[model samples]
Target: ILIGEKRFRQQSEDPRTSPSHQPEAGITPSPSPRPRSPDDLEEGEVEEVCEICTPPSDVLVVEGQVVEPFSTDHAQRLIGQIMVLNAQIDRMQEQIDSMRYRLDSMQQEMKNMIDVLGRI
Candidate 1:
């Protein structure tokens, strides 16, 4: 997920603009350091200019296949599908509860019959 934009500020090697590198009047100037590549940038040099944008959702599936670059429409579709699945789960739970109730009733009846037979 891409949460924010990252901006990098590279340090300028120009000695004239930098006060710390200004040479003393009588001293010979020291040799300049070797140029650094983008990969060599220190941690502090990379600045994060955070513009908060909506993060992309986890991997989405379309028609039983995985899709890329999840959008708002895809999130909406996933939400709808989740709602449908929740409804189905509720119905199935109700059915299971009904079956369990029936089974318990049947078991009590069997126990009662066994007691009556034992009395005889």
Candidate 2:
């Protein structure tokens, strides 16, 4: 009884264990990381960005852009393209994962079939 009560107390304290952890009735989960905004980087480029943390107010300096304000619209468009390309890469990754799963299943099935045939 003590153990059960302790477990119940711990679970209630844990936000993840509570009923609220489930989505509130009608609240749908956001879509998968697919369909990202233009600001997202391309697939492998995520690895290249420096992880250095900076203060929110820190100003970035770019030496050689033709326009003032650095033509952020161009940057957005390029980033948009990169985002779409990244989605494609993610989709391809899922495809590869699925292929691997299927390959594993097939190999297992083939082995089972071979064993059964040998028994026969």
Candidate 3:
């Protein structure tokens, strides 16, 4: 079933108003619910399409390799690196701005000198 269909069905039936939710209806035993693997997921579950193919395939393996969870220290180190890179970028931008101002001042002075020479 599509993800939208499952969501619609869930929304249509309000658990509070349903007879199943009522205590007098008696607890209905559910069917054997087994854990679903990545292979079991439908096309709708994975939004992204394959690079080789235009449409997404049903047999898409979302995650191939098991990755280790990131620790607090690892995240902190990444943030530190980002901060250092940002500082470098800011310094480069300031240098560029300074160079532009110097160029503009030189151009203005040259124009003033040309105007003075024209008057002679």
Q: Provide the lowest-lDDT 10-residue window in model 1.
A: 51-60
Query: Model 3 RMSD to the real structure?
Result: 16.5
In candidate 3, what residue range of length 10 has the lowest lDDT sum? 2-11
lDDT of 3 by residue, 21-89 (tens): 333322222333343556778766753221221112112356778878999999999999999999999
lDDT of each: 0.59, 0.56, 0.58
lDDT of 2 by residue, 71-108 (tens): 77989999999999999999999999999999999999
lDDT of 1 by residue, 15-101 (tens): 333554343433432333444555666755753334332212211336765658889999999999999999999999999999999
The TM-score of candidate 3 is: 0.46
Could you tell which candidate, 1 or 3, scores higher by lDDT? Answer: 1
Q: Which parts of model 3 have CA positions greater than 4 angstroms off?
A: 1-63
> Candidate 2 at 98: error in angstroms?
0.8
> Which candidate's TM-score is highest?
3
